[model samples]
Target: MYRTILLPTDGNPPARAALDRAIELAQTYDATLRVVSVVNLGDAGILSPETVPVDGVRQSLRGRAEQIVGDAVERAREAGVRAESEVVVGVPHVEILDAAEDADLVVMGTHGRSGLKRALIGSVTERVVRRCDAPVLTVRAEE
Candidate 1:
């Protein structure tokens, strides 16, 4: 029943798991996979004035994000699934939610952190799950 599947990746194991799942689902449902990698600019906001060039840091993050999404798209294509990809610079959850507007389903990876650790380090997947309008399918990373 899916026409478009959204896959967000950061090149982490959990993201990789989500990629595999997304590819499979796309193949099954004859859907197109939209792979996206977000470059979080929040780190730049937290840095001191003495840090290295902010432009250089942003370029680096953008490069990494492009590589991540490009690789994910390649993997999906090699698996015989139609895929398109993009690199966005913004809050991870916000960008993902925005991209999800045109998607039939969203498949993402959850780090599966809980309790104190999860409280201290907020979860993007959790935030997206709470606010996303499309159906979300989360793949947990293997420990």
Candidate 2:
């Protein structure tokens, strides 16, 4: 049984699909939903002088995160689910794992990218699944 469900979104198509599933599950179980969007801090150590400034990058990321989570929260509300949203700036996987402490379950979407692409970009869902103490439900993006 789930009382509080955490759904992390990035405004990606896959994430939207996962949000729908999370909402359906929340409704079925009479649970509250908490949507979170993490703004990743890009590589600070290796940035060249010609690269975009770190502060500018962070601001852009934060703005996008806010927009994504706000939209997801509105959708959840429209579905008659009690929903709250938060935007955090940090490592995605670490923030998600920390959030799981207060949540009964974490529902996330997987892009299903593999090999070098997956290794370079990494998989937040996989990291969350491996590290979070709470139950994680991963929904792969539909083809």
Candidate 3:
């Protein structure tokens, strides 16, 4: 039933697993896949660094996001799924939710971190699941 699927990747192992799942779903449904990677400027409340030239960091992050999305596109192509990619700079959860507005579904990876680790880092999937209007599929990373 999905026409356009949005897969957000962080280039992490968990995200790779999610990409695999998204590709499989896209292939089965003959859907167009939009792979997005959001480059977070900083953690929580802290800004990266004013002295370090924010533009340079943003450029670097975008480059990395491009590479990540490019790799996913290649994989999707091999699977015969139509794929497109975009890189955005912002909080991961916010960007993911925004991108989902035009998508039929949003697929994302959950690290499943809990306790102190989860409390300290927070989960993008959690936020996206709460905010997104489209159907969200969350794949948890294997231990």
Which one is best on TM-score?
A: 1
Which candidate number has the best lDDT?
A: 1
lDDT of each residue in 23-142, candidate 3, tens digit only:
999999999999999888683223755566767767777788899999999999999999999998788888888899999999898888889998898898988888889989989878
Q: State each model's CA lDDT, in order.
A: 0.92, 0.88, 0.89
Clashing pairs in 1: none
Worst 10 residues of 3 by lDDT: 43-52
Model 1: per-residue Cα lDDT over 52-98, one tens digit each: 68887788888888889988888889989999999888899999999
Q: Model 3 residue 98 lDDT?
A: 88
Task: Provide TM-scores for the models.
Answer: 0.95, 0.90, 0.91
Q: What would the per-residue lDDT of candidate 2 be over residues 56-122, giving only the tens digit for each residue?
A: 7677778888999999989989999999999997788998888889999999999988999999988
**Candidate numbers sorted by lDDT from highest down:** 1, 3, 2
Error of 3 at 48 (Å): 4.0
lDDT score for candidate 3 against the true structure: 0.89
Better of 2 and 3 by lDDT: 3
Off by over 4 Å in 3: 43-46
Decide which is better by lDDT, 1 or 3.
Answer: 1
